[model samples]
Target: MTEAVASDGNHGSGPLEYGERRLLHLQAARKLLTEGEPIRAVARHLVAAGGTLEPWAVAALREAAAEAVALSAEPEAREFLHTARQGTDSPAVAAELTDLDWWIRPAAAVGALTELARTDGLPSPATAVLVRRLAWHGRIEEASELLAARPDPGIDGAVTDAWLSRLYPGAFGARTGAPALDEVAATHPWLRADADPGAVLQGLALHRGALEPLQMSLLALDGAGTLDTEAGWFADLLAAARRSSSRVAEALLIAARARVELRRGELRTAEESAETALCLLTPASWGVLIGMPLATVLESLTEQGRHAEVPDRLRATLPQAISRTPYGLIYLRARGQHFLATGRSRAALGEFLAAGEIQRSWGADHPGLSPWMLDAARAHLALGEPAAARELAGRQLRGPGGDRPRIRAGALRILAGTVGPGRRPESLREAITLAERSGDRLELARCLAELGRAFTEAGQPEYAYAPLQRAWRIATDSGAGLLLAELAAGGLGGPPVDPAEARGLAQLSDAERRVAELAAQGYKNREIARRLFLTASTVEQHLTRIYRKLGVRRRSALAAIPGLVPAADVPRPGRPRPLCARPGMV
Candidate 1:
C-alpha cells in the first residue's frame, strides 16, 4: 500500500491521514485528475508505505485520472482531451467540446495548465486536457507554450488553431481565439486602401463626447464590425509586438475605455476591453489602469438598476487592484460603493469595513486611509445607520490629513441626507458647493440629485426641482443616461392629464407606444429595456420618436398624460417612494 503523507486538503473522506496512505493516494489521484491536474504530478507527489514514491503509484494516478477525465461532461472538463490535443487517443472525447463560447474566461485556465506542463514524462491526454482547460479560460501564455510553444494573440481562432496544429501536431494546445487586439493594433496600423481614412473623422463628429481622431477611427471600424474577418491578418502584427516588446497596453486600455463609451448599451465591451488589456499587461497593471472605466460601467449599470449583473465581474476585478497598488483606501471604498450602486447595500458596507481592515493591515499613514474612511462612512450611512454614519463623516471630515475635496463633499452629501430637514439644508448646500468646485462629476451628480431628495423630503418640491433638473441635465449631457432616465420618471408637480396628447400616428410604432406607456408610468429606460431586452438606446430611440409623434417634447409632457402615476409623487433616490403605495402617494 502506498504511504500517503499527511495531506492538507480534503479529498472527500476528511484530510487523508498519513497512516492511511493507500486511501489517501486513491483520493488525491481522483481529485487531482478530476480538476485537470496532470497524472505525473499526482504520481510524483504520492508516497509509498516506506515514504518512497513508486512506479505503481504513478501508474495508478495515470489510470485513475484518465478514467475520471474521460467521464467528465463540462465543456471545460468534458472536452479537456480534445480541446488541448490535436491528435487524441479517444476520438469519442474529441467529438464533444469545441466551439466559440463566451462562457470561458481564457486566461484563468491557462495559468493552471502552465503548472501542469512540468510533468515527469511525455504529454498524456490528462496533461493535454489541463492545457486546453487553461486556454479555455484565456491563459494564452501558458496554453501557447504548452500547446505549440508560440501564440499569435491577434489572429482569429481558426488561423491560430491551424498554425499550432501544424507546428506541434501532437501537442497542439489552446484551441481558442487569440484575444490580444492591442498588440494586433500596434502591429497592424489602421490603414486600408479601399476604406477611406478621412471618412473616420466624419464619423466622430456625430458623437459629442468623442474627441480623439485615432480612437474615433478605431471605434468606427469596430462599430461597423467589418474588420472581424480581417482578424487573421493581425497575426503577423502580434508577432511583431512580441519581437519588439512594445507597450501598446495604454492603447488597449483606452480601447476598452472607448469601447465602454462607444458600446454604451452593451456589457460585452467591458469584458472585451479588459481581456485585451489582460493579454498585454500583468494583473495589477491592468487592474489599476482598467478599474475606473470598469467602475464607470458598474456605476452606470447600478444607476440603471440592473443590479443582477454588476457585482460579480466588478468585484472580481478588485482583489488584483487592491493587492498590487497602494491605492489608499479610496479605490477599495469606491469598490464598495460600486456594490451599493448595484443595490447590494449590505455587501457595500462589508466591503468598506474590509477596506478599513486593509488600511490597518497596511498601516494608518498609508494614503489609502482617507478613501477607506470615507467609504466606510458612506457605506454605514447607506445601510441606514444614520448615527454611526454621521459620526464617521464628522471624523473623516475633521480628522488628520483632513478630507479630500470630493470625499468631503461626498461625506457632506450623506450627512445631509441622514441629518433630517432642519439641520441638513445647510449641509446639503455646502456639499453641492464642494462637489461643484472639485469637478468630480461622478460625485457631483449624486450630490445634486441627493440635494433634490433632501428638499423633497422637507416639503419643498419647488426647490427640489431645480437641483433634480440640474442633476438630470448633467446626467443627460454627460451621457449618464441611467441617471437621466431615473430623473425623467419623477412624476413631480402636476396632475395626470395636464400634459399633452399624441396628435400624429406617424411617430409612434406599436412597440414605441408600449414603451412610452411604460416609460410614462415612471419606468426608466433600463427597466423598459429589461422588460424588452433590447438595448437601452433602442428604447431611447423609440422614445425620441414618441416625443415627436405625440408632440410632447420632454418626459414632463408625457407624465401629465392620464393613467400613469401623478408627477409629484414619483420616487427618485433618497425619496424611496412609498413602499408598495399606489402611484399617487406623496
Candidate 2:
C-alpha cells in the first residue's frame, strides 16, 4: 500500500477513490518537502483538510507552515504552526510562528518577539518583523539601528530595506540614481522619470510572475501611484490581488485603487473602495498603513460635501506612528482640506504648514508628494493675505516638484487669484492647460471657474459665460458639490425665466417638488439623489420632467420662481433674493 501511494503521488494520473486521493496527496506533499520543492500547494491542501498531522508528517508540516507564512496565507500559516507545535517542540518553528503572528496581531506578538530577542537573539524573520513594526510605529531611528545591527542578506532584508528607504530616503545609503530590482521605484513607473511607463508596467508584470502572493502585494503597495496612464496595469494587479488568499494584499491594492479613483474625481467609488479596504483588517493590524485608506476616505468625503459624516470618521484616533511617515503628511493634508471646506481657514493653515514642516525636516518636501504649500497658499488667500498667498504659490512653482502638471496647475490657479485682472486670465489659461494634461477633472473645473471669475471681474461677462458653463458641467458630472456651490455663488446664470412659468410649482407632485427645491438650492444631482434616497438617474428624470412642466431650460431658472421655496422660508418683497444656498446650510 505504501509503495502504491508513493508511486501514485509521484506519477499516477488515473481516477481514484476519495480516500486514495487523500493518501496520494499527503504522500506527494511529503515527497515535495523531502526534495525541498515549493510547498505552497501542499500547505494549502493540508490547511484545508484541518486534520491531525501524523508524527511522521511533523517535519513536512513545519516546512509547509514556513511556506504559508511566505505566501501570507495567515490562517493557513497559523493552523500549520499550531498543529506542528502539537506534534513536536522546536525553537525554529516557534520563531516562525511568532513572525507569522506579527502580521496578524502585531501588538500581541511584539512582547513575544521582544522576549525572544533578549534571550536567544533575534532570528532573520523576527528581525525583519521587528524592524518593520518599529518603522510602522514611527520609531524610525530605532528601526534603523536594529536593521544595522542584524543585516538579513535575504529577501526579507531586501523588502525591509526598500520599506525603510521610502520612510527615510537616505537611511540605508545614498541613492544610485539607478533603479534597483528590490526598490519601490523599479515597480512604480511614475517614480522613475527616465523609464517608459508602459515598459515599466510590462516589466513589473513579468517580474511578478515568480513572486509569492505576499511579495507581489508588498511590491504593489510600494509602487502605488496615480493610475491615470497605467490604469490597465493597475486593473491587472488589482484583479490578481483580489484572487489571492492574502487579505492584507487585497486591502492594500484596494486602498491604492481608491486613491487613483479619488484623483480621477470618482468620489463615490473612491469612498467605497477606501471603506472596503479599512474593513479587511483590524485597526491594530493595519499599523501605519492605515493612513492610506483613512486619508482617501476623508478626502473623498470632503470633496463630495459629506461634512456630517466627516466628524464621525475623524472620531477614531490614528496610531501615533503614522505621524512620522509620508502617510502622515497625506493625512494632515486631508484634514486640512476638511477644515478649509468647513470655513476654518486658520486651523487649515496650521495643519498644512505642519505637514510642510515635517516634510521639509524629512527632506521629502516635494510638491508631487502632497502639495501642502499650495494648500497653505489657499488658506492664506482665504484669510485675506494675498501677498503671503502669492509668496507661497511662487515658492511652489519654483520648488522641486513644480514641473508636475497637477502641482503646477494648482499653484498657477492660486497665483492667478492674487494677481490683477490683466495677468489673471493668462495664468488661469495656463492652469487650465496643465489641469487638462493632468486629467484631473476637479482641478480642470477649478481652473475654468477661476478663469470665468477673472473674465467677470474684467467686465467681460460674455467671455465669463462659456467658462462658467463648462465649469458647472464638469462639477456636476464629477459630483463635486463644493465646486458646484462655489460656481453657483459666483452667479452662474440661466436664460431669462418666463413669468408665466411661476405657477408650474403647483403642477408638480410632492416628490418632484422636493427634488426641485433641493435643485434650486444648488444641490448637484448626486446630492439630491442621496437626500431623496433615489438614484442619480431617477433624480435626472425628475428634473427633466420638472423643467418641461416649468418651461425652464436650465437649473438656475428653478430658483427664479419664489414658489419653489417652501412657504415658511420664502423671501419677502424688496429684499434681494439669494439665488442659491450652500450645501448643508439648507
Q: Which stretches of candidate 1 lie over 4 Å from their true place?
A: 1-245, 248-297, 311-324, 327-331, 364-370, 400-403, 477-586
Report, for every candidate in turn, its global Cα lDDT versus the true structure: 0.47, 0.68
- Model 1: how large is the Cα RMSD against the reference? 21.3
Clashes of each: 20, 0
Estimate the TM-score for candidate 2: 0.69
Best by lDDT: 2
| Model 2, residue 114: C-alpha shift (Å) | 4.8
Best by TM-score: 2
- Per-residue lDDT, model 1, residue 402, is 44
lDDT of 1 by residue, 68-90 (tens): 33332123232223322322333
